[model samples]
Target: MASLFQRRRNKATQVERVRERRHEGFLRYAGFRWAKISASLCLLVIVSYALVDVTPRHNGGSWYGYTLGTIGAGLILWLTALGYRKRKMTSDHWSLKAWTSAHVYLGLSLIVIGTWHTGFQLGWNVHTLAWALMMLVILSGLYGVVVYATLPAALSNNRDEMTQMQMLEAIRAFDRQLHTAAQPLTPEDTAPVLAALDEDPFAGGIGARLSGRYPDCATAAAHRALSASRSSDAEAREKVVGLLSQKQAALGRLRQHLRIRALLEIWLYVHVPLTFALIAALSAHIVSVFFYW
Candidate 1:
């Protein structure tokens, strides 16, 4: 309806707007289209379970139960495919963001499908074992999703735009300062200060890092000793104590960095292996059923 020049202007504006649009994260990718689809799928399974009638008491051997089982197995395979899909890079329709969104929602929907497949039956058998493992896998994945969504922002805030190495270097710099400040103090006082200066901030394993609890920390121990003792050289002792406090602050930041990093990473250690184990158990359940039946 517009003139030629106005049409050209509108086209240019549209291009510019598209260029300036914010990048969509995995959760909101495609306007959470996958989430709504997954929700509908779960609702469908639940409603079908309510409506379907099976003879000789409903159980995993029933027709509806088998249908749900097949769907759950296929969904599990697709959900696991995200691990492989993430390794490839592409900006086309099947982007990593799209894959991740599907993995999360569909993985969650498995809770309903897998449970309904059992028809609320439980026992000490391979079938129930598989169900328990599937629950574990989904629970671990949900933990990953929760931490991934919230912890990155907290990590960035804690880092204050600095890289990991930069934070470590800052701690080392404080250690050097502590060493220099302790030079004028007497041996009795300098002993604790030197211990603080030589303390390693990154000396702990995953347990120590995640727990954020280091009772045997040398720097902390030294600080307590220094604060409790009264030395002859008050000036030098005060300087040493101040440096120890500074070193403690640096170590605290370092430990916090480690804590957040561990929280972000620890889930994968549990999530990935449990997933394969779950699939294996599910397979065994299937094989045992057909073999024994």
Candidate 2:
């Protein structure tokens, strides 16, 4: 019995390792388990919407509409809970990964549930506002998903195993070399080298960071100015120019890193605020339905 138990435990451990390797992404979680469930749900809603007949045709005022509305509202509330779920870390049946998978797939099903609840009757009202907000939230979420899936690898590759501080250090080292190399040059040539040394790597604002374009880069300007020197101290000018070129290359890599990071995070600025607006609009919609309508 002891030997049998040991064998079973070893087999369980091997199986678990395989499972860990296979279940790497939330999109493919449980063999797309949530996706299959969500698809079935959408199909059911679509089929029921077509088959079930209501007096004066289906509309938000009908019993069927109210039922669909309740389901949709419930789903919205649950999906919103995902923000809270992220606060706690767990690896159980309802793990964060599992919750996120469900959030994405089930949240997508709202398009069917919400539209069917309206019975295709849309207008200029809080109901329509709520629907629009939900769609915006979903679209923003899709954008976040796409960036998260694709940009992380690019970010890692661009980093080249160096931390941000290390990149800055490299530029600083080039500046030190430029300072020493400029000592023998004339004042006119040294002025540009000094400007490059004093230039801030992070001088540009958010616009420049996101775009990765530094039109006013002092390093580049200095390199250009020094490169064109026809002065007597040709060797000293060349050394300064070379250091400036290396500094510019370092700055480019750093800016590229900033741009990728900005792309990854900017979506949250749109997504989180819209989620709050959606909840507010959704609340007003529910209250109006029960009390006023």
Candidate 3:
């Protein structure tokens, strides 16, 4: 019976070992090789552009320069297509992470090829506009990358697994506690607290939301009022003050959440509008090149 049991255990362990090896092999081929190929291709493009010199003629466009520029522009457009195509592809087939890795490296390759295509010329033309827009888009995308990489961890820590709703609710609960604590205050003492509660938290217009500077925020006003008020009952005043302090802390957390969320969202405003402008500029550039020259 002991020998039988030992034999079963050995077989189970061997099967597990085989599965582990297979998993590692799959990851090696699919994961590492994908990154390796992307890196190698990007290097090849960069090196080729660096080694080749196709300076533009002074009077007219050189056929060689035109060809290089066309190829480079085609690659840029192709890279853009890859971004959209990768979005549509299944994760099992090609992971979004791998696609993004390829996108970043290949996008970097464009800078080398694009500069070579330009021959380092800048002018007030559609060509220049297109190039400027492309740079803007690339820079904004880089901003997004940085924000995603760094802020997400900070956001998670700030949230502590709580949703935004939960955070707001916590703030409101603290406010309720403050309200109860403030009840014992004389009419004169309670006047500011009442005024604070009367003001709207979300009444600020679009400008205030975008600026993130809410001068009329009830929480801030209440803090100031609590600081300035003079009361005879030291112990009661201290208790009320402590509650106000807790409410202020909770309000700070809520505001931090709003600030971070706003920062994350604000970039999209620049990025999306610029992307549309780039598309239009690129179209105009292609049309002007073919029509005039």
Candidate 4:
């Protein structure tokens, strides 16, 4: 009986430990294990690059350069495996969080590995092109890391305890109220209300979403025009204007939410394509090296 109780308690403690590790952020995974490893790798490469006496100085064709190139190429392929790794699940050391931590740090280490591979000998060739593409991919990845780390809090605060669907419903409710309130107004006054109702909440495209600017938004225009009205049914106009104002505020919050999401996701649009391009350039580079030799 005592043995059974001890076994159950140990099992419960193990489950709790797994739960705590699961909630920890990837950057701090295993207490920055990947960061330390990547830094050490870079330091070793830099020291080797400085100490090794490559005959006729260093260039991509040198023996030392070949070693760095091999390391960089392998690292790139491993880093790219992260996309596939995301589809798999595990709770041990090779979990998704650990894979991501390694991906980020190792990816950054390419700056050192790749630059040393070139041996400071850049030019207008496929070799240079591969290096440039790699740099671009890294820069975009860095942007992705920054936004993921910082913008999520802003996104949560903007949500204000409302689901996206709820926010849209709130806008629609205001629109219904505006429609009923405008019924007593003249045709001229009703025109703006109609325009506001007709406007699409998401019509501005990617640029507008990212910028959070809708200079020609019909709802905003309607609100302004109705607020300035001197019609005899001023009370009705005021009511419609008030509804428009509420709808406008709702739209602002929705757009702000979208802007943050866009910023969060736009890097992938750049990063993924550039990564493929880098691979192609890298392939070409390797082939040319062997072909010329």
Using TM-score, rank the candidates from best to worst.
Answer: 4, 1, 2, 3
Q: 77-115 in candidate 4: lDDT tens per residue?
A: 889999999999997889898999999999999999999
Clashing pairs in 2: none
Worst 10-residue stretch by lDDT in candidate 3?
A: 56-65
lDDT of model number 3: 0.67
Q: lDDT of all predictions, in order shown?
A: 0.85, 0.90, 0.67, 0.92
lDDT of 2 by residue, 1-293 (tens): 99999999999999998888555788878888999999999999999989998999999889999999999999999998988999999988799999999999998999999999999999999999999999999999999889988999999999999899999999989988988888998888888788888898888999998889999888898888888887738777777878888888999998899899999999999999999999999999999988977
Off by over 4 Å in 3: 1-60, 78-89, 199-216
Report backbone clashes per prediction: 0, 0, 0, 0
Top-TM-score structure, candidate number: 4
Residues 15-130 of candidate 3: C-alpha lDDT, one tens digit per residue: 99867644543224345665476467557655764666555431114554476567667766765665477558565545565566556555655565555556667788888888
RMSD of 1: 2.7
Regions of model 4 farther than 4 Å from truth: 1-20
Poorest 10 consecutive residues by lDDT, candidate 4: 230-239
Cα deviation of 30 in candidate 4 (Å)?
A: 1.2
TM-score for each candidate, following the candidate numbering: 0.91, 0.90, 0.76, 0.92
Which candidate model has the greater lDDT, 1 or 2? Answer: 2
Q: Using lDDT as the measure, what is the rank order of every candidate, best first?
A: 4, 2, 1, 3
